[model samples]
Target: MFVLSVLLLIAAVVLFLVGRGKERSASGWKLGAALSAVAGLLAGLFACVHVVSAYEVGVPVAFGKVGSPLTSGVHFKSPFTDVTSFSTRPVDLNLNDDDVVEVRSSQGGVLYADVTIKWAVVPAKAVGLYRLAGSEEAVEERLVLPDSREIIRNVFAKHTSEEGYASAREQIGSEIADLVKERLAPRGIDVTFVNLRNVRPSKKLQEQIDKKIQQEQATERATEASRTATAEAERKRIEAEGVARANKIIERSLSDKVLYNQCLEAYKEAAKAHPVYAVPCGTDSNGTPVIVDGSKSG
Candidate 1:
């Protein structure tokens, strides 16, 4: 558009020179000159207009100097200025195993985190972004990716290796998101959220973790066995005490008359089987029964 406007203006200048301010032919040339000049100025005006899209904010730059941002609509600027549009849409910057972030836990154990951060350049801050980082790619390189990776590492560093690997992973992600947002807001990056996934200990750290887990499992099994044995011993003790109590109760309940009846019943049963008769003998001082089994003479 700038080139077109310049060409039109040149045409107007050539027509005005051809008129030379003279006769009928000159007068006609002069009219043509006036029309061409007007058309040129209109073209120049058209060249100044910039259309910013709904999801974009444009910053005008002329000869290395940055201008105020243009919002989502038509705006006019110096025809010499070029508008650079920055997207305000959320974009994913996934740092998977391909870009794993190395973190040292508080316990000095090493691990890696696979992170995905959703972020966008703030529309109102687009001018600042232009001043700081020129392109969207530059913003990620200089501000977004590096800053987020460092924040993730720092947040994970505050926890033990286990927390980074599994235990407090969600909490670590939240912390990372908060820190990245806080750190990059002034730099014109709006971090929506940080997702930490596929986190695990480093190779050496993993071997150590596996060993620790195996030891814990063994200790648990031993403790359970000990508990079971103690319970069994307690149950046997209770059973023996019950049996002893039962015997004592039976001994206390028996009297001399009870013993004598039991003996008599036994003798009667024997007589039933062998025709024997039970003959009572005098009891001793303790008064237990004495009985003799006599066979019936046939």
Candidate 2:
């Protein structure tokens, strides 16, 4: 557009000069000159005016050299210079199953991860970014993607497959984001956030982890059962000891006189229940009691 405007302006100048020199065809030349001038003015206005959206920053290029950055809103530049706009808003780059990254674990097991990186070009560095990286797509392709993959691989290599799938997943992502930020900040890209959406170990590794967990649970249960059985045996032993102690106290209280009195009371109770009865008067040979009926003794 700028080139066409310059061409139209040149044509108008040529026509105006020719009109002034001619006497008979001067009005025709003047009319053509006026039209050309109007066209050139509109084109020049169009080329010089630029609107940078709220989310975008513009970089102006003069001839072949890159110029300063332009913030959001209307801006004016030379019609000869071109302004290129790039979004300053956060952009999400997802690397999922479709673009899964394979990495090795500390234990030499393979792991796959799905990740996302949220980033944007630094607004102040728009012109420098354009000069260095060309475009947003180019920045992602040349810098973001390769750097993210490399950082992830390096971080994952420091962890085991179980760690990748479990406790260390988030930490791994954070480390990647930090490293990538350090690597790209000097180049005008800002790494805002990184997410390790999913990490999966190989099928064999997963099965082994599951088995190990089951074995640990079983061992815990067995330990608990052993503790319970030992407590029960201790309780039974204490109860038996108490019963034996009570028996010993009772046996120590008994005497020969108490036993003779008890035997006499039993014989008296039996005599009241029967006219003729046998009773134990005393102990005879072999410690056996000798009983005689009252009628047989008479």
Give me the candidate number with maximum TM-score: 1
Residue 10, candidate 2: Cα error in Å is 7.5
Clash counts for all predictions: 0, 0
> For residues 151-239, could you state the per-residue lDDT of candidate 2 as single tens digits?
89999999888788898877887888889889989888888888888888878777888898999999999999999999999999999
C-alpha positional error of residue 114 in candidate 1 after TM-score superposition, expressed in Å: 1.8
Each prediction's whole-model lDDT (CA): 0.85, 0.86
> Residue-wise lDDT of candidate 1 within 1-298, one digit each (tens)?
8888888888888888988956668878888888888888888998899899999999999888888888899998888999999999998898976788888999999998888888998988999988888888888888898888888878887999988888888888888888889999987889887788678778999899999999999999999999999999999999999999999999999987787778777877876888555675338786544544455343
The deviation in Å at residue 141 for candidate 1 is 1.1
Colliding pairs, model 2: none
The TM-score obtained by model 2 is 0.72
Displacement of the residue 26 alpha carbon in candidate 1, Å:
18
